[model samples]
Target: MSKNSIQIFDTTLRDGEQVPGCKLNTEQKLRIAKQLDLLGVDVIEAGFPMSSPGDFKSVEAISKLVKNATVCALTRANKKDIEVAAKALKHAKKPRIHTGIGTSDSHIIHKFNTTREKVIERAIEAVSYAKTFVDDVEFYAEDAGRTDNDFLAKVCEAVIEAGATVLNIPDTTGYCLPNEYGAKIKYLVDHVKGIENVIISCHCHNDLGMATANAIAGIQNGARQIECTINGIGERAGNTALEEVVMILKQHSNMNLDTNVNTKLLNYTSQLVQQSMGMYVQPNKAIVGENAFAHSSGIHQDGVIKNRETYEIINPEDVGVSKSSIILTARSGRAALAYRAKNVGYDLTKIELDVLYPEFLKYADTQKEVNDQDLHQLLSSKDNFKKSVNF
Candidate 1:
């Protein structure tokens, strides 16, 4: 409820690790936790303790080393889960136990086979139990996106009274559109009692490709905390990419929200997570993607060559990316070709260049890229490059 700061709760090691084959070892999780601390996240949901012994160890190890952020452990709405989550987070300078239950009728009926009143009761009991071990208790309404508005408000009110310091509204299935998600947060803001005293958070997935949009929308609707992951890795499509959401709040004045993340560490942290998961980042992935700054078009490459800002809204350096890359390809313009050639110490006359371009095209097609060494060899040989000088 603080008007001055927006909290970023990074769930990369917890919910993100739930993605198939994305599980990280304790050392890896600790490495990520250290990085997250440096990145300045308000909280790091280290892992779900009851999932496995490995996960419990990860949460415990991370809890020991995390200094700047509140080290948190996730739990279900049960005492055993809350106790395990508490033990895993016992070593933290600041610890938070994030406990929750499903609130939607669909989840209550199909998932838990319980009634709405029982769902609210379980949520209150979970928070009350978690508060026994940690002063910071965050309660989530799993599948809140599909829950009835009035029932969701009622759940939030009851949980706040039960000592929940933060209320996380998760779009577990990523079913809400941006506007709908925003309205959900706004509704809670208006209706939930003591909502101003407890932090409101967003946990959106990318099933409909709107996770980040929904997260931003939640911010606009007065939610101060965003629960997201690196590269959007999660259960299904993924959660909101923390990099995108942080930068969105940073670069856009319309959403004057701000997070504690050090934008410079984003790319490295992303790579760490990717490497730990044994998955490569898609080339076109935003922010940390290999092609995020790679330009293949003629006009765009030319502009990027002259001024990166002309083609890129974000400075590559802001996300630990070095600079824009002017990649020469079939679509590359003369300016890019010339610039690249010059980097390798070639200064061909327009007339000479016109003759050699054919060979360049042939080589370029065979390889993914044209390098300086190949260009040098072709230009050095007068036998291939020379012609009747007529320009």
Candidate 2:
């Protein structure tokens, strides 16, 4: 991989499916997994093989089906989970076992009921065991967002020494600010021994809606791989969105960071996941949302009609969208009205537009949106509008 290239590790099939009511059958999982591989993701976290028989089958099937991307299976820091994950991934051209234990004090004491020393031992044991099965092993310090930097550095160094090829520092609870998360990654980069040999990965959650920011910060500091999901689907609020981070890196070329993702397939992949999982993306959601390219406000519409870059940072076609939508609402201006009017074959002159503007506003005010049919009716309903029509 190039120094500036970021590895996109998509866990959509696993973490994304964790959302309540977003479950997918094996067939659906296969469909989405194929799309993800085609979308140029570096790794696909197929599923947690030990979670259930169905998940194991899905992971096994995906391992065989995926040709290019490394098929990864998630596991806790244990031999049994690592064994199951390895069995499921035996057919993969390139397989990865992702295993780790929680390192945060909250998780160590409250969740694992263990001391930090024991937690580090389990982390090392899991990575070493996983290494025996797959050459590419990723160790995650679960809830590393809150893990002490000194202790987190120790865990990372131990895993790297234990043959872990990747270290995933996850903001499991989505609690860190971007600066803090970046500093944590920097601390690991500076403090951990032999860290230069393995890739640093970021796995941030969206409980506080800062997952994207935190993931960006991680990469800026030292992380190379970003674990994300399509449409940001996951447990609780969700994980960092795949599309958002991909586009952010692309748009900010000064950062000198890019990903393998095919920029155009973002919307199509998002729709595929949404349909397969039946999870609805909010209209205003970033990147692949319905309104991402839609212009509704009058000032915005006018600016966009003149030049798309005036209001849109991204071209609609770049992400598989056909065109930008110039939605006509009461807030729409004369320029937007004339632009929409021209699309429906009106081609109204300035004088004609002036005459029709009041009537259009009257109709637009009564309705949420004024479409082509509405404009046709509005123009034909009155003799004055009929006279004003260029036709």
Candidate 3:
């Protein structure tokens, strides 16, 4: 891996499918998995093999189909789950068994009904057991965002020592602010023994709409891997979006991080997931959204027309948008009106445009937006004008 290259650990099939109405069949999972492999993600978390037979089959099929990316199967920190995940990944060229347990006090006391020492023991034992199946094992500290730093460091150190190749610190409930999440990752990097040997991964949720921010903070602090999904689809308000994080690193080169993702395929991948899962990406969602590069306001359209960089940070083609859209609404300026007119096979001069602008506004006021046909009619009306009589 390059010194500044971040590893994209995509969990779309496992986590993204957890949405209530987004369940996908094994064939759909395989299709998305193939696209993800081409998209250049480092690891594809196929599914939790122990969850059900259908999940196991999805993992197995994805393991067989994916050629470039490592196929990973999720598991609980226990014997049965680890065994099932190993079986599901038996045919993978590069296979990983991702197993972990809850680390936070709330999860330990309420969710597991176990003590802290016992939880740590289970974590170590799970990693050691998983190492027997495959050399690559990822240990997740579920809900580590709220876990005490000292205890979290202890668990990280123990897992790294026990043959785990990756340590995942998840903001399970999206409770931490960016500063807080960065501090947590920094603490683990400073305090955990043998931490430099393993990859530090960040898995964040979007309950507070900060998943992308928190993921960036983690990378800036110390994390090298981001566990994200297409369109940020996942359990409970979704997870960090792969498109947003990748583009953020690309646009803000000052961050000094890069991912292997072929950014041009981002929009295509998002659309595939949306169509397969039957959950539409919100029109205003970031990065791959319909309005992501669309300019409608007069000031914004004028700035974009003059120079796209004035208002748009990233190029539409950079993410497979083909071209930016200048939507003609009541608020659209004359520049946008002319721009759209030229595209529609009309070249109106300033004099003709000045005559047409008022009528355009009047028509725009009566509708939501002015389409090409609408603009054509407005221009045609002027062409049919009769000569003025000077008698």
Candidate 4:
């Protein structure tokens, strides 16, 4: 991988589908796998094969279908889970088995009723066992966000020595701030022996609404891969949004990082996942949201109309949005009103616009943003214009 190239590891089918009521069937998972491939994600975490027979088949089917991206299966750090995942990915063009155990003290003592040493042993053994099935093995230190950095570095070193090709440092509970997360990844890079030979991947949750921020910080600190989901759908609040991270890198060339993601497919991919998972992307959500490119404030609408760069850092077409929307609300100005009018087949002169502006405002106050149909009604009605004072 190039030093500035970031790998987009999409966990939508595995982590995203784990949301309650969002579980996808085998065929549905396959459909999303195909889309993720088309979107140029570097790795597709297809499913947790050991979770269910349905999931096993879904992973197996996706493995057979995906031709470009590496098809990966998630598993616990154990023989049974690893074996099942390997078997499911048997036919993949490029296959990976992602297996790991929790590294945080809370997960070790309470969740597993084990000691730190025992957790390390399990992680090493799991990665070594997985390496036997496939040359590509990723070891995740679950809940590493809260794990002691020194101990986390130790675990990462042991796994890399044990033949792990990728080391995933996950903020599994979304517990770390951006600075903390970046420091954690930087510590691993500096302290973990043989770290340069393997990829450092970040998997972050959004409990505090900082998953994307944390992931970016990870890359800035040397992590090379981001594990994210389409539409940010995942457990709890959600995972890091794929579109958010990709566009961030694209927009801020100063970051000096780029991903394989074909950004034009981002909107379509988000929509497909939203529909498949029965989840809605909030209007103000970043990147692929409905309002991401819509300008409504008078100042914003005018700036966007004159030059999109004034208000928009990203072009609507860059992410497959047909065009930037200049919504005509009561807050909109004459410039936006005239822009919309021309689109719907009317060209209002400045004098004519001044005449229609107040009536447009009166009608817009009664509703949300004025749509083309509403504008037509306001423009074509002689009675409505009759009330307007001549300008």
Best by TM-score: 2
Q: Is candidate 1 or 4 superior in lDDT?
A: 4
- Comparing 2 with 3 on lDDT, the higher-scoring candidate is 2
Candidate 2 per-residue lDDT over residues 112-213, each given as its tens digit: 899999998998899999989889999999999999999999999889999999999999999999999999999999999998899999999999999999
Candidate 3: Cα lDDT at 222: 92
Question: How does each model score on lDDT?
Answer: 0.87, 0.94, 0.93, 0.93
TM-score, prediction 4: 0.97
For each candidate, give its TM-score against the true structure.
Answer: 0.94, 0.98, 0.97, 0.97
Off by over 4 Å in 3: 383-391
Backbone clash pairs for candidate 4 read: none
What number of backbone clashes does candidate 3 have, counting pairs of residues 3 or more apart or in separate chains? 0
lDDT of 3 at 357: 79
User: In candidate 3, which residue pairs get closer than 3 Å at backbone N, Cα or C atoms, i.e. clash?
Assistant: none
For model 3, how does the per-residue alpha-carbon lDDT over 102-196 read when each residue is reduced to its tens digit? 99999999999999999999999999999999999999999999999999999999999999999999999999999999999999989999998
What C-alpha lDDT does candidate 4 achieve relative to the native structure?
0.93
Best by lDDT: 2
Question: How well does model 3 score by local distance difference test?
Answer: 0.93
CA displacement after TM-score superposition, residue 81 of candidate 1 (Å): 1.1
